[model samples]
Target chain A: MENNNNIPIDDLTEEFVVNIGPQHPSTHGVLRLQATLDGETIKDLLPVLGYIHRGIEKMTESLGYKQSIYLTSRMDYLSAHINNQACSLAIEKGMQIEVPERAKAIRIIMAELQRLTSHELWWGSCAMDLGAVTPFFLAFRDRERILDIFEGNTGNRLTMNYITPGGVMFDVLPNFASSIKELLVKVKEHLKEYEELITGNVIFQHRLKGVGILPRELAISMGCTGPVARASGISCDVRKYHPYDGYDKLDFKEIVIDGCDSWARYKVRMEEMKQSIHIIEQLIHNIPEGEFRAKVKGVIKLPVGEYYQRVETARGELGVYIVSDGGNKPYRMKFRAASFSNLGALKPITVGAKIGDLMASMATIDLVIPDIDR
Target chain B: MKSLFQYLKEVFLGFYSLWTGLKLTLYYFTHPRKEIITEQYPENRTTTINIPERFAGEVILPHDENNKHKCTACTLCEMACPNGSIKIISVQEESEDGKKKRVLDKWIYNLGMCTFCGQCIDACPQDAIIMKNSFELSVYNRNDLVKTLNKPGSKLKEKE
Candidate 1:
């Protein structure tokens, strides 16, 4: 027989490699993390991506400006409305279209509601990732109310192509304000329940409090945005700095935490959910009664040039860039995915932490995998 | 003595936090009417399935009584569709004045590829089509997915 030579028992190294998932549930989508471990601590971690890349950007090149906006919703399905807003803003910018006041108010309301839904999903899944299953059910129970509200107005729950070039697809329903007020009350009450149930738990705190610390400089250098960066004391909320759609006029505070750890990320999202409610409360009662959508030409052809628009999605900043050849379809389209940039910081923050803390780190970053892959 | 005091305080604080979490769960367990949950899907369909009226499921070309439809076969829905799921096959016919006029024939819809973006309905100037809220659209045959939206022997309704 030929020599069956492998690494001899005497020469075995302490460092070993472990694959978390290209198809694991904690990942929330198809994301594979190859972690090199020395005993229990991760020596080095590398994220393997592109498992669910549906060629969304390339597909946008062939589709018209109107059709291409819907593809972004599929990219970050949790931030579907926000993704749609960014794409619409880019098109609206290119064509010099002025979105009506009523449309702007509706857009803001929908965007903030989607943000709450996204954060609720994150909160539930974050606790679930750390081994508690109850929060998942609790989170979805609250989320269904918001999705019901979305379905009533947008006609679809997840990938609502409701936000379009000049304005939204349709006007808000008659009971929109009353339903939102009712929802705000319910969600506010549930937030207190969530605080009691998971936020104060000793085990959860010990697992999260100082684990996977991401400092301010590292956060900025990594191009992190949204709650992930804010948790690290980096005030990079695009809403505050570069306010779009009616956010500038609204009275609200950006929830920035200086904890620089997983717990801070958790707290930041919780507070942000409250801020989202505050934003919604400001706009709901006073939605300008006027035309829902402006008169956009049947076919949208962006003038020959490059165009860009950025919006703060649930995870972070989503930038939509389009290059037009004076045609209905874009010559090239690029999505600056916040998850991809935020994913870069995962390895740096988690390399020296225990392998078990990796889940805590991943969950707090709040990555929606299709957002990263797209 | 001081070190012992610190250790005791840590244990007490830990237990207190854990109790708070458990307490919330206990409250929910005791009070049951407020808890929201879902029913079994197929079973609920016969009992209390309440799908929203605005839910987009499948496209249908609405036909009026007297076997008349509103489609002029403009093919705008075909152009509006991101996927080429809709095809308009029109035919020309001679009127009573013997003048040749183009008219609607077949509206072929591939439900398999439809994203239900509702762009097709929005593009129809005639308001000839609307999305029905019936979402139970599963069939054993693949060919059943491709629908001939316009009924056979239906004529286009002239504007009153």
Candidate 2:
């Protein structure tokens, strides 16, 4: 190795620094990674964030409780419904308002549909990251159906601020049941296609099988949640442990796998899509008839205390914490986004792996940059 | 001979997996119309696309044939807006009963900064403003986005 930068020849190491993205597609969003590489093997990795931070938490402190729910949707845009739901749950808990049963069922159905859409997008993008283009097209085809359903009812497709403080914004559409049943039938058939396309492919399996192994202990210590933790045999599903939004009334299994590798993470998400479908199927036909929103005061004021609410988003557990001084606006607002903690596990998992394996490990983590930065 | 047999078995299994993946793409490729997902935007604008009734495209002030509106100049929507997109200007007027009344002079809606969260519509007590399903709000100039929602010579409707 040539001695550059006037370093002592005897003390110089052969490792070279490689900067991967403030704009790379594989990072999923605007995230910069400083990777130290000795040839093809990674020695150390550091994730540099704050490219897409919009000061969402600080902004929420100035807005009223009703106005703050809309801002959470932009944090995890894929899991927009769940992000809004977490904020609303926090406000509802602070106020001690009992949400209507009909609204609870509707919230669960929307959250699960949002989960399916998010996972389908993740599957397509993750496959595309690994050099498979066909799955991307197929995945988006199915996701469009879900977006259309959201647009029809919520008035917006991506950032649907449908879940309010006490309950949902509006009642389910007249054909909500029939439309979801039709989509579920199509999604079930297409899931088999996903299995054949990528799950059984030998090339993909070789790339993912034991690439970046995250041990169960390390995952828990790192505060990982959702499919990433479940893949490592960590039973930290918020829906199961906490059971908010009528998730306790539903029958579904938390998907867990012990492989603790990129393949395990992929399999966990695939199985989660099925569980989401199962949950939706149980509640679709039995939507109760009642008012969608509870009659709370237009100007909602929280009690003078601290409140924390956590819900299982498509990524992981999203916790919304608010401190109120019995005011219209919150004194302090903070979000424990899953991508932030999940991003921490990156360096530990990818340190000794190849540069190519870095992409695979990141694909499995499914980092959405705004969620991390916020 | 045993090593060679093991190598051949591995090759056969790999090919089988590859074939399984290819079979799905071939099926979609053959059924083009059924599998194609995207809509032809602008080209099929009127025929294929239907903007849902609840979609929050742009804010509008619904007016009657008599050029009367329902806004009472309460500025509730302005207070509820997180981004200050809605600005209501009120002018005090003396009514025939010798009582002072606040009348809305202008309702300026800035389309640029709007997040379309529908908070303004929810906060409007008089049901004067609503989100219309006309999403084509693109304008050539930034000033064009700042629209005066109330009509030129309209008056507030009498309280029922």
Each model's Cα RMSD: 3.3, 2.8
Clashes of each: 1, 0
Collision pairs in model 1: A21-A32
The 0-to-1 C-alpha lDDT of every candidate, in the order given, reads 0.91, 0.92
TM-score of model number 1: 0.97
Q: Write the per-residue lDDT of candidate 1 for residues B1-160, one digit (tens) a residue.
A: 9999998998998899989988877777888767566657888888888777788889998888888999998898999999999999999899999999888888999999999998988778899999888888988999999999999999999999
Kindly report which residue stretches of model 2 are placed more than 4 angstroms away from their true locations once superposed: A1-13, B1-3
What does candidate 2's lDDT look like per residue over A1-374, in tens digits? 86587877545668899999998878778999999998888999988888898999899988889999899999999999999999999999999999999999999999999999999999999999999999998999889999999999999999988999889987878999999999999999999989989998888999999988999999999999889999999888999999998888889999999999999999999999999999999999899888788888889999999999999999999999999999999999999999899998999999989999999999999999989987
Best by DockQ: 2
Kindly provide the TM-score of model 2 when superposed on the true structure, using C-alpha atoms.
0.97
| Model 2: DockQ vs. true structure | 0.84
DockQ of 1: 0.74
Sort candidate 2 into its docking category.
high
